[model samples]
Target: MDGAGSGVWNDGSVHVDDQVGQGVSADLAAFLRNADDDRPVKIVSSVCGECGGRVFVVLVDDVEGGAERVCTGCGGRAFIADSAEFWGEADPGEAGCPCGGGEFETAVTFSLAADGPVRWVTVGLRCEQDGLCGIYVDWKIDYGPTDHLLALA
Candidate 1:
């Protein structure tokens, strides 16, 4: 949280505490550290209905529309009707990792700005077993995760 929403470190990662993606993701984590208690992030560990799979979800926002997810098992796709519900975990534990094998490795750096006007955030998870890989879309209908982040300022 040294330089939230600011510069980059020697390693090339953002200066913000990467608490959500580990200890090294974005300034969102630094903001989350000071987030309001009333508006806590709503996180869920959903079991894939098609394959009975547990996942560590990374959200992806579709600027044109809603949220989407690709199943790790059946390759089935699921969409969250609300695009704002999904938010990154400040602690960003390993439990959300879709890959159950050998510790989930980063398939990609899920950024909060990828959604453009929609401002959707997406994180990637890769599983060594069956190569289970996918993202979790923040589909919360009640509130905007991005808005909440902005409010933190």
Candidate 2:
């Protein structure tokens, strides 16, 4: 239980089956890996969907997989949304995109356990005006402010 609070997974960990799945195409992965200003796993944090708590990922190397959680405070389980649902709207300037583009796009991928529970999520942000982007992973803690509007829907 050295990292009981923080677990480590691979860059390609999809499906609860425990094998490995990148869940992203080669080109996209390459783009993120080569982002100008940042590494893929730089800063990935999220809120606990169960109780609205912060869950920051301590990624080693480049594990893009999502996180599975048993809400310690609420005694319930929570999951990260798939990349499709995890995308957040932001200005490239705010995200530190080197392109300084007017539009930024984020794509995420969610991992689900075979038992039908979600494990974790990976996110990639890119500047639509150019292709400057970055990548990261975070716990599916909650619908954080970035996702508050979506959570309401």
What overall lDDT, based on C-alpha atoms, would model 2 receive against the true structure? Answer: 0.35
- Prediction-by-prediction clash tally: 12, 15
On the 0 to 100 scale, the lDDT of residue 7 in model 1 is 34
Tens-digit lDDT string for candidate 2 (11-88)? 442111222122333333444334422222211233445675432221111233332333334544433343333334
lDDT (Cα, tens digit) per residue for candidate 1, span 26-79: 332333323312222211223345785544233344333333444555654444
Regions more than 4 Å wrong, model 2:
1-26, 29-93, 140-153
Per-model TM values vs. the true structure: 0.31, 0.32
Q: Candidate 1, which segments miss by more than 4 Å at Cα?
A: 1-38, 55-59, 62-65, 83-153
Q: Ten residues in a row with the worst lDDT in model 1?
A: 36-45
Task: Give the whole-model CA lDDT for all candidates, comma-separated.
Answer: 0.33, 0.35
Evaluated with lDDT, which candidate comes out highest? 2
